[model samples]
Target: MNFAAAVSVALNALRVNALRSFLAMLGVIIGVGSVIVMISISQGAKAAVDAQISALGANSLQLRPGSSFRGGVRGGSGSATPLSDEDVEALRETVPYVIAAAGIIQQRGLTAVVDGVNWSTEVAGTHPDYFIVRDWDIVEGRAFTVPELDGAARVAVIGRTVANELFPAGGAIGASLRISGVPLEVAGILAERGQSSWGQDQDDVIFVPATTMRNRLGGLSTAGVRNPVQSIWLGIDRARNMEAATEEITDLMRVRRNIRIGGTDDFAVVNFAEFLRARNETESQLGLLLAATAVISLVVGGIGIMNIMLVSVTERTREIGLRLAIGAKQADIRNQFLIEAVVLCVAGGLVGMACGAIGALVVESMGQFPVSIEPMIAFVAIGAAAGVGILFGFYPAHRASRLNPIDALRYE
Candidate 1:
């Protein structure tokens, strides 16, 4: 038969059993929908994380204390040895690639009260450079000035969440809020950052000058000496030089701290790029696992196609015998059955693709998750569905081809 005739015959066969055709297509629909939905969600999460990381500012390096490693495993050493004011100054003077750096000291369990309304939140002490490094903006008022930091001014910048909680009527700027019982004038109100996927409110914290936090809060003291810093955040001039800058800073810090070659460096320098890469790898693996699970449904659907094809071969024995007796070649008989199988799978795949697209859109609209459906993924899915049809339909098509004309003619 010609290609057109073969396709026409396949269409007629499917039309004769509309319910069976739909049942066969259901598996592909489920498989494609599941895979697409999982991928869309994963992509959304990755995008959210990327946005948060980028909001931390480009080429930002965080310096904290590294845990003491013992026996090839991480062992918790108490809180990281505090970075000092001297260390911060040394980095500024020595590191040419460092554009800006700010020392941070954080204190939780602090209550801020304004207008008789109190809210418990984190209070972080940082320099004016902190706003620059974090890409933070003062929506209503100015950031702390250099003079404020030097004089250890009791000025505070409240996050959006803190502002709303403490001053529900929205006029928090220029007000005074006592943090940990220390009166601090509200210097500014930060813009809203929204909640993280981990359910943490990114805008619930407060910012203060590092010096004021160290002196007034009194949380930095340890073992008879006041450890004045919790971390130093650095923003690099060039993103491409982050790795080289990180290594140079680490060496500079070690030499300044007087740690010998054999002695472990007491501090940790973190590269945000490394963290982003690790997170992407984990998400990629999860996507693979979910896609595999979804593909199993396609396989199950393929099996259903095979079963139905077998029944079709048996029921059409008389038709096959009549065609063979009239001048049909073995190749013609095989091609007919193969076309029917392919038609079933391809139809099912087309339906599945539409359903998957709709499913992704619905999920995105309903859950507020970003949905990205790459064209290549759709192509791959269609190809996969066609492959399943051929692989599973092979045996039944061959059996139909091998039926003896005389035996098939007498069967009915």
Candidate 2:
């Protein structure tokens, strides 16, 4: 038979046992569907992490106090070597790559009351530059004036979460809210920023000048350092490498904070770029593991296809003998069965793609998980299914082609 005739016969044969063909295709369907869904979700997670990192700033570094060891037990960041206000000023002055910097003093457990509504929230104090460094914008009212920041003025900028809870009404500008028994006027309202990568709500806090936090809200940690801070944030020049910027900052901090060359540095210098790279690497490894599992499913499905093809060969032995008794060649029988298996798997793959797409959408809608499907991945999955058919269909086709004409024709 010609190639076209072989294909026609193969398709007809599959149609003859439609239910069995579908059962044989089930493995490929599941394999392809699962892989696509897993990959889409993985890509979506990576994209979210990248966005959160970018939202931090284009050229930003976060410096927190490093570990403090008390009798071999280590205290984590901000436990020792608190970031003094002078250290924050030194980075801006000493590092040319540093464009803007600010120290943050954050205090929790502050109850904000306005218009008979009370909400527990975080209160942070930072310089005017904190907003600039973070690229934060005020949607209502105005930012703190230089005088307001310096004076530790009783003025506040609130986040969207705080706004909705406290005011409830549309007008929050110029409204007065009291925090910790101290009254402050609403100077500005921050635009809605979404959650962090760590899943913390970004718009659930309030902002005041750095001086105000130290003096009025959260008390000073030490009497010696009048305006100590929890951490220092800086926006470095994007053109400069993060490592170089870190080094410069470190050298300056070592001298200012009085650290010897051999001793460990008392601070933590973190670049978002480094954190992002590590996170991507970790996620990629996880993706690879998932891919491996999906591949195993495909392998299992291929085995199923092979088993069904073997049974098909046995049931068609007499038919093969009859064809051989006629003008059919060995290659013709092999080609017919091979094409049948491939067509079965390819159809299964197509259906799997549709099912997988639906599954991903359902998951996204119901679970709020991110899923981003790429066109190329779908094509790849379909192609993989076809390949599985060819690989597993070979031996069965070979066995059918080798059947003895005399024996097969005499057998039931």
**151-200, model 1: which lDDT tens digit per residue?**
88999998999988888887777888997689998989887888754678
Measured by TM-score, the strongest candidate is 2
Task: Summarize candidate 2's per-residue lDDT along 1-412 as a digit string, tens digits.
Answer: 7888888999999999999999999999999888888788787778877777777877789998887766777887667767778888888888988889998988887899886678999999988888877878899898887699889899999999999888887688888998887888999999888888778899999998888877787655774665788889999877356779888988888787777779777687987766886888788689778877988998899999999999998998889999999978899989988999899889988988888888788888887777788797778788999999999999999888898999988878
**Highest lDDT against the true fold, candidate:** 2
Clashing pairs in 1: none
Model 1 stretches astray by more than 4 angstroms: 1-8, 41-45, 48-52, 66-81, 137-142, 180-185, 194-199, 214-219, 222-227, 238-240, 320-339, 350-380, 390-411
Clashes of each: 0, 0
Model 2 whole-model lDDT (C-alpha atoms) = 0.85
lDDT of 1: 0.81
Give the Å shift of residue 374 in candidate 1: 6.6
